[model samples]
Each structure stands twice: as C-alpha cells, then as structure tokens.
Target: MLDACYDTSVVQSAVDLANTLKPVRGEDFLESVGQLHDFLDDHPALGPVKPSEPAEQHAAGARWSLTEEDLAEVRSVRETVRAVLERASTDAAGAVALVNDGLRRSRATPVLRVGDGGWRTEVVSGTDRCSAHLAAAMFGALASVIATLGPNRLGACAGPNCRGTFVDLSRNGSKQYCTRACAHRVSVAAYRSRNNPG
Candidate 1:
C-alpha cells in the first residue's frame, strides 16, 4: 500500500503498473511495484507534498481482495494509462478519457472519500477495494509528477532502443537519456560516428 500523496516511489509504481500490461513482459505485479520504487528514487523531485487538513476516514470495513481476474482488468487499465502517457498529444481530455477507460474496463464504481480535508477523487467497486486503492494511488502519483515536472519535461527517453519515459528535473534541461547507461551508449555511438566518419 502507498500513501495517496506526492511520494515519488508511489508515482513510479503507478507508472510501472501501467507498463506491466504491455504484452512485451510477463505479468509481474510485485516486480512492477519494485521497479517503480527504483525509478522514483532515481528521479527526485525538489518538492514534497504540503500538509493539508487531515482527511476523514471512511467507515472501517473488510479489506478487498484482488483476484487474478481483477488483476488482469487492472492491467488492462494500466495499459490505457500508458498509452495516454506515451502518446505525443496527451491533453486533459485524454487524461480523463484514459482514467475513465480504466474504470470502465475494470467495472469499478466511483466513490468519494475525504482526504486532506477535501474529497479525494477515486473510483471504487464493491469487494474490490484494492483495485480502487491502486487507482487512487496512481492518480495521486500522476498528479505529483505533473506538478513537479511540467509538460515539456515529462518526456520519453531519447534512447532509440528504450521505450521508457522520465520526468526531467535537470537544471539545464539537457536530459536526453533516461539513465546513465543510456547516456554512455549514446556518447559511445557519437564518438564512433565521429571517428568512422562513414
């Protein structure tokens, strides 16, 4: 479980979860979460979540279990999120559509919760609260990333072989690679190109 706040790891986890749905990789939910944590740690935002009025707790109830079928549906929604994020023109309308598409795919119902002295925006489903929690966590994480990295900075990796995206917080805005390895690869390629001149 993750706090519905601007925790970098949580956002990364949400993004990873979104990526897990791709056919290229096997379904590994826990692995996705772990990868997300690593990514968030690597890309630190200079800001933190501001404290707000305490959110009201919902009625205590039995925890929801995510069945395999439910997990599959969640994965599908994640794919939609990934598509929206990867697309070149992802506007507010696209974001909302992606979120709603996830809800529709999962058959999740919308519920209001009091958080940070205000209503938390989330979609819920009976007997599947975990899915709702995951969705909410993702929503919070995405919001944090957007606030921290403006649109221009949230870019896909420039590496030709990599499909990963990153929120570039670099001071000089010179972030062309997602990781040091990618940078090294690109640099070596450039050096070879210059030497070969072919």
Candidate 2:
C-alpha cells in the first residue's frame, strides 16, 4: 500500500510514457535517445528513488548513459505498461499479471522516504539500468493506484481518434478522455452529428 499523499507524478509519468506512442494517431514521441532523455528530464520522479542507493550516493553529476539498448528496453517496458493500463478496466487479472511480472523483472522494491513534504512510498529497482528503474516506478505506481482506487481507474481515452492512456486520480474517478481537449473534441463531434443527422 502506498501513502495517500504519495506523489502523483510517478503515476502520471506512467501514463505519459504509455501515451508517448499514440497508436490511434500514429504518433510516437519517444523514438530516439534524445527523445528518451527529454522524457526523463520531464519526469524527474523516474530518477533513482532510493536516497541511500549507490546511484544517488555517487550523484556527482553522474547520469545514466542513454543508448539504443536502453531505448529498446524502455520501449518494451512501455508495451507492458500500456497493456496493463488498457486491460486493467476490463481484464484486471490479466493486468495484474503484467504488473506483477514487470515488477519482478525490474527487481522493484518499495521503500519509504521522508522529507519536508512528508513521508511517501517509492519503488526502486535493484539494478542501475534506466529501463529497470523506470519500470519499477511505472509499474509500482500503477499497482498502488489499483490497490487504492480499484482497477477501473486505469483506462484509455474514449476519443475514437485517440487511444491515449490515463490514470484517473480524480475524486470521482470519472475520467474518460486522456485530456480535456480530447474530451471536448469528442463532445463537439457528438453534438454536430446529432444536429446534422448526416
């Protein structure tokens, strides 16, 4: 179980990672090593979670080297993460299997961290592999959401032209679209069709 106040950034990062490859729109935001670096920069929570870990202990401007291999591995992680998000609502057991397998493969372990902002639980991987660390954060966050808010909270956008994924952290858990823009687009389209009758 995760702290109720656990940072939502990790959860959002999982969704962002999955949405990087928009299947319906045929747009992939994470294609090159540079793009992966951008993704990592955007989501700092995906960094080394354990403060006492060697990775952090040696943090004298040390950063993981991004390579094609890392990109490939992360892409594979994305597939598993995306599948879990897409299936959690309908096939929770299947989704759980993916999450469990990912966590195991990533060697993820939950750790409690205390800071001025308060205490929170984070999942850190045993290895220094960027993909493994990312998988731990992504999979662990998804698992925490499912444990706390039920599997129905994970879903893909309702927009026909968009298969973007999202984690509903709203109080009502009524999210259907990946973004407000997508939801508005869908609503407007529905209205136009109803009025024109064509």
Give one digit per residue, the lDDT tens place, for model 2 in 12-116.
989999999989768899899988888887776666644475334333113677799999999999999999999999999999999999999999988887755
Best by lDDT: 2
Model 2 Cα shift for residue 31 (angstroms): 1.2
Residues 1-198 of candidate 1 have per-residue lDDT tens digits of 123435555456555655444333344443443343343333333111112313323221222233555455455556655664565234655664665555454454444556444654443333333445455555545544454554454445677666565545456656666578978998899999999997
Let me know the TM-score candidate 2 reaches against the reference structure: 0.92
Name the candidate that leads on TM-score: 2
How does residue 160 of candidate 2 score in lDDT?
Answer: 88
Clashes of each: 0, 0
Evaluate all candidate structures by whole-model CA lDDT and list the values in order: 0.49, 0.85
